[model samples]
Target: MIIFGTALLAVCHLLGIFLGDLLGQALGVKTNVGGVGIAMLLLIFARIYMQRRNMLPKLTELGVEYWGALYIPVVVAMAAQQDMVSALRGGPVALLSAIAAVAVCACVIAVINRTERPQAQTDGAPILHDNPLLTEAE
Candidate 1:
């Protein structure tokens, strides 16, 4: 059950790393090119596909979801390890890229927020009602 999901996740992670390395090499960059993110995306898509095909067990899906939830925290921790001072000092290009990324993310969030419909409002007051069984005829 869970073992199958774990195996799938592991394979995706390894493949992502390999692809990232290849991408970095192709781009003449030394850093991994979004390997973890790519891995997470792959795992999510694979799980979705499996679920659609009715091939995924509940236990396996739960396992995948647990690890997927950990992805953000893990990625954040990894990013915290990067030397920001050195990266910033590297060039204006890095700073510009960061600014662009933030801008893009902000725009995407705004769009998503705008696309969502507002929930209907309601009061919590209880309604009063007369008992039908307490009529004069009774």
Candidate 2:
């Protein structure tokens, strides 16, 4: 059932919050850092594990996918809540870290592209259609 998927998400979210809190305490921060990100990662791994073990039901998967679709917008909304001005005023550390993170992500993407097998080249011919409307006016 869809409720099962929601239950899984809630469980992961709780664990993520706990871990984030622990990490924050370790780093001497007062807030839960990366809790949402950790929860999303947990959700991904959980989905993958369930699929591999043939445990994910159609309804549950649909519920998970529905939430996944909202993930980006939700993240954007959360990020919008952050104090960008304060972060900038804090120092160049935030800026530098952001740049470094982007650079590392780019490099990783390039490496993955290089290592991935190339797809077979397709024929250049345009497909012919029986419908005259889909065909070019002769």
- Candidate that would win on TM-score: 1
Best by lDDT: 2
Extract clashing residue pairs from model 2. none
| Candidate 1 Cα outliers beyond 4 Å, as residue runs | 91-100, 117-138
lDDT of each: 0.85, 0.85
Worst ten in a row by lDDT for model 2? 129-138
| Candidate 2 error regions (>4 Å) | 119-138
Report the poorest 10 consecutive residues by lDDT, candidate 1: 129-138
Candidate 1 residue lDDT tens string, 1-138: 778877888998998898889889999999789888788889989999999999998999998888778766887777856847766777988888888989999999999999999998778546476767655555
